[model samples]
Target: MPRLLWPLLGLLLLAGCASNKERPELTEVDQYREASESLESRNYLTAIDQLKELEARFPYGDFAEQAALDLIYAQYRAVDYPATVVAAQRFMRNYPAHPRMDYALYMRGLANFNMEKGLFDNMVSSDKSSKDMGAAKDAFRDFERLVNRFPDSEYAPDARSRMVHIRNQLARQELHVARYYARRGAIIASINRAQYVVKHYQQTPAVPEALAIMAKGYQRLKQPELAEKSRDVLALNWPDSKFLDNDKQVDLAWWPDEDDGLLSLLTFDLL
Candidate 1:
């Protein structure tokens, strides 16, 4: 009688435990699906709210991770740089080993890239305050990390292309400032800027222009030997460069002397 009573008691406890266990809620799933649909339709604000709510309610759950990633994307698409950075940082912290970690890092970089100053805007220092290019540099560094860590990622190619574009823009801005100084009769300032462009961005299209400016600036300072050397390099690399026409008459002063040889050949023809 005692053994039979103990077995009945155990069965009753098991039944109670089973009855107390709650079933998984479908509300979060429903909300996530609706928010995803809204995001697909370009209703980013609504999607962001829904994703945020889902994450707050389901924190530490699988859907929470998904919500965080979606929130980052929605913020990115809406051009909310600050929010995007926050979301990306949070996603990295929560899902450190996630397969999409590369994407989050890349997007973080892009958020800062969008905030970078324009090339022409940077040149107008008197009108506009000087801009900090640190953000652009950071963006490039992040993209480089993505490339190095995930070389086979689909985003690597575009990241590389954007880096080149940003570098070229920076180089072009420096060249523009150098020309501005040269035009203002600030020979030393112009030479300094031009030399910086040559040293830092030798591969850019602005290199030829920078070289021409450096030559012209040196010539103005009465450094004819250095001016001639720069001209020789410019002629060898970009004979038809448009920058050669920047200072129309001034460039002729540095042009190599071919008149003597031409006259000698013509004299021989006359003979």
Candidate 2:
């Protein structure tokens, strides 16, 4: 009977330990749930504050992990890109093996992407020069990394789509610089930039414009043969491009006199 009493006492002690350990976690989880609800309602500031409290009270617990994720998302939703980046970085550093690691990485990239400025917005209207393209380029690089590393991730398709747009924007910015140089009579500089755009962004919408600019630049430099060649390529690739009208006006008399009639046929002003 004494031995039976000792075993029963041990069972009671174990039960008490289990109860003490579980209650705090349950309470923390309930708090986290409430904070999440606030976030869902778009009360970002309040949600962040609550998430901070939850993290403080349950550091190293299950609720803490969830709190961190919510905190990052709240900062992002609030358009606090800098804070969002920091929080995402911290989360990745602290929870490298977390089940939601892909989400954290994707959020980090998204934070940077959201902070990127369009080239036109950053350009100086007087000179049409950009103050800085670093942020935009960094954003593109970050998104590319995510897509390459997590090809099967839910964010991969969107990342790929955005990358195409980013590439187009970058190409357009370069084209703007080329146009500025062309207008200033800096033929060499303009040709180099336009060529860069044509080579690198041939698939983008800017390609047709870039090719046209290159053709004009070549004509300005007295390279009539090269200019006509570029125009022909542009017409073949983008027959309906607006630049074709301008290409037609560039004189190509330097070509063999007999070929002038053929050049005229190709250069007919469709617009």
Candidate 3:
């Protein structure tokens, strides 16, 4: 409130700001420790910044390698999938035989796995087959490579589980495409897509539906023999199939249909 004190107060505030701003940057070891601490504390942004600083200042050492791995994990925790993938791949490429290769590979798969849109989302969108499955496909291959190359790696089991999930999703995506083509009267394309699911994704939950689609599609194409063969497979594998019970009607009432309350019927069971 006093006029004479105002200049002094302003000077004090400016000095405080300068002190805060000019605080010494951490040394390489200190920066690496800080990044590790931040990662432990779940402060991903701070961890990422500190890791990047450590990497830039000390580019080739054990600490740098650890920092790079930390950076990938931090970016992933921060939901920066693309950055995480790039960092993981860089780590793998730079240190092909590093003891942590399993981690890098697993993180790469996880980054793309997290990037994929939901399965049912692809089902109802314009065209499931035409939709760019780049991320899903990439994730699947990444996991497959991990499982195949490092079967005993600590991360292999989880990678194998993810591969199974990706396989099912891919199969379901194909089935959704088959359904779309069938509805649009593209018999050959529909049959091909369905057969792809049954042949390539035999173990997936979508196989029975794929076979059923093939049966209905072949019948529509006027190939009774092929239809009967597909029908036999569908019946043998899934005697209780709803599609089997519905004959050639395509009993996929879960998807939108104008004849019913389309929005209400959307259950979105991807399988």
**What are the RMSDs of all candidates, in order?**
16.0, 14.5, 6.8
- Better candidate by TM-score, 2 or 3: 3
Model 3 has an lDDT value of 0.80
lDDT of 1 at 95: 88
| TM-score for each candidate, following the candidate numbering | 0.70, 0.71, 0.79
Write the residue-wise lDDT of candidate 2 on 213-264 in tens digits.
7787787679999988888888888777766555454332222232442344
209, model 1: CA deviation in Å? 0.6
Q: Quick one: best TM-score, which candidate?
A: 3
Q: lDDT of all predictions, in order shown?
A: 0.77, 0.75, 0.80
Compose the digit string of candidate 1's lDDT tens values, residues 156-267: 8988887887677778778667755555556688789889988998788878877887787788778999988888788778877765655432353322233532443456
lDDT of 3 by residue, 47-69 (tens): 99888878888898569888888
- The worst-scoring run of ten residues by lDDT in candidate 3 lies at 256-265
Model 3: which residue pairs collide? Answer: none
Task: Please say which candidate is ahead in TM-score: 1 or 3.
Answer: 3
How many clashes would you count in candidate 3?
0
| Candidates ranked, most accurate by lDDT first | 3, 1, 2
